[model samples]
Target: MRRLLFIIIGLLSLVACKTDKTSVPQDFECFNQPHIYIKYKQPINGYTVKVMWLQNGEVGNALFCLEKQEVQYYYFTEKWTDKILYDKGNTYPNNTVIELDYTTKLKSEEYLSDDSPFFFSDVDFDGKEEFIINRYKSGSRESNAYDVYNVTPYGYFIQKTEAPFTELENGQCKFDSENKTITIYGSNGWNNIINKTYQLKDEKFELIK
Candidate 1:
């Protein structure tokens, strides 16, 4: 009887241990929290990539490689950001130049200029910076791409760009800092033209007309 009781106690102890183990959550488990998703098309490779940012989570940035059919993870903190490419049970090398190119284009213009790329600067002097991208036609045969960037008190920078302007069309920008919004003025060389605004909130960027 005493041996049987000991066996029962041992089983109960094992059960208790399992219960305690499950009580503590694993750090790597996904919490399904609110996050932001951003998508952009690569100018060089013509690949559609998705960027995800988990708001207030451990995973700072995650990239989905649509062309290569893979996923790349990045850990970002206030000081630095590190990228880890998961491939076949091993980490692959990160294409920082390609990533930076895509990110710069996404942040500013759709078409990236090979000669005069877009720039960033702090135009409003509000400590927060902005982006400036140049737009020009390939057939124009004119050096129309002019971009610049200026530093700001805030961590980010500001941007400015120069393009062709007509009497009916003028260059202007509209900003909404509270919602992190940016707008660009478009011209059709004639009438029926309107200003367009873009909002960058929660990792998603949308064009508002």
Candidate 2:
């Protein structure tokens, strides 16, 4: 009976200790105001986690959490730093290379001085995630901030070979990370709306009717 009880206890301990994946809500300094959301990893066992939410009376800007020293840390700022080496707004203390995706629109040659929110996923479905920069503005935010990127093996961010959307207006996007699909809805005109869906294929966005 003693040996049987010990075996049962060991099985229970394994059940309690197993962690395939974990989801948690983390608060970060967004737009100098506090924001919260259920941010999860794309593949759950993947290399990165992303946080994007609505702020400034709209949806844009994002926070990225990096795992280092057996603890998680986030990179967020009330202001955009002009540090040349600190591209993508993620500046860590030990100069660790946190993988950041750069999209075609927000490439290294382009200069966007304003603070931005971002979206990340394996939009290309190449087993790697990409990023899109979101903008905040006074009167309204335009839909032109849909720059996307894929991460190079060397850790440099390169823009996507093709764009996800040909045009964009004021709107929000829903990313289906599981299926690798992106659906966007935007106000096209006074009363019309633009609804489009794109799937990742051959490293390009294939529009779905």
Best by TM-score: 2
lDDT of 2 by residue, 29-87 (tens): 22223233323423233334543222322332334343433544343322121122234
Give the C-alpha lDDT of model 2: 0.41
Report lDDT (CA) for all predictions.
0.35, 0.41
TM-score of each: 0.24, 0.37
- In the range 1-209, model 1's lDDT, one tens digit per residue, is 43344345434333333442344356623433233443443432323444333333222323222322242212121111111211123322222222332434333432223322233434333454443333332122322333333333332222332221111111245555676666665556677665766666454445655
- For candidate 1, the 10 contiguous residues with the lowest summed lDDT are 77-86
Q: What TM-score does candidate 2 reach?
A: 0.37
